[model samples]
Target: MRAKDVTGIIGEEIAAEYLSRQGHEILERRWRGARGELDLITRDGAQLVAVEVKTRRGSGYGHPFEAITGPKLARLHRLLLEYCAAVHRLHERRRVDVVAVVLSGTSEAHAAEHLIRGVEHLKDVS
Candidate 1:
């Protein structure tokens, strides 16, 4: 796979781990619907959450959260609805969330040294 794809996968995994530590039960990862894909599906108590994960090696380009645009959020909202319909959870409480992950290192040689620069979770984003 491409490096970008690898980065995304790693980011999603990290986001999942982080959420799990925060007491969220992960329901799905990379869930695709007719509209788009959700990076992670989790349950926070009685509420269902759809998470969008954005990862970046560095902030030279922009922060990971900066990638989530207005149109993107709208698409995520539609995808969440589609997911709910598919899982027969239309009556459950749901909300959209974003998890931004930033890594500190850039080279494969320094992979072991690479650390998570930050993890920012925004709830009810849409």
Candidate 2:
């Protein structure tokens, strides 16, 4: 795999591990298609969460969470709609989360922070 692809995989692994440690049951990883890509899908308590993972090399580029701008969130929102329809009927209990993963090339170095219950539905998409 390419450098970025490898980094992305590592990032996802970190995110999954963190979620598990936080009492979340991972349901899926990289739930994606032509519409867009969702990094992780997990359950927190009684609610299902759709997560977007953003991995970065360092702080030079900017904060990983800041990369998740409004347009990106909108796409994630639509993808969440697809996931909800395919997996379950209820929508009120679902939420969107952002996982910011910081990667290091050195061994024994990795970090991930899951932004729980982040992102809200837009008032108007049109």
Best by lDDT: 1
Task: Report the lDDT tens digits of candidate 1 across residue range 2-106.
Answer: 777877888899999999999999999999887778999999999999999998888886988889899999988889989999999999999999999999877
TM-score of each: 0.94, 0.77
Q: State each model's C-alpha RMSD to the native.
A: 1.5, 6.4
lDDT (tens digit, per residue) of candidate 2 on 31-126: 975697788888888877787777767556776777878898888878877887777646647778887776543322332332232212221221
* Candidate 2 TM-score to native: 0.77
Tell me the whole-model lDDT of each prediction, alpha carbons only: 0.90, 0.69
Stretches of candidate 2 exceeding 4 Å from the true structure: 105-126
Cα miss at 35, model 1 (Å)?
1.9
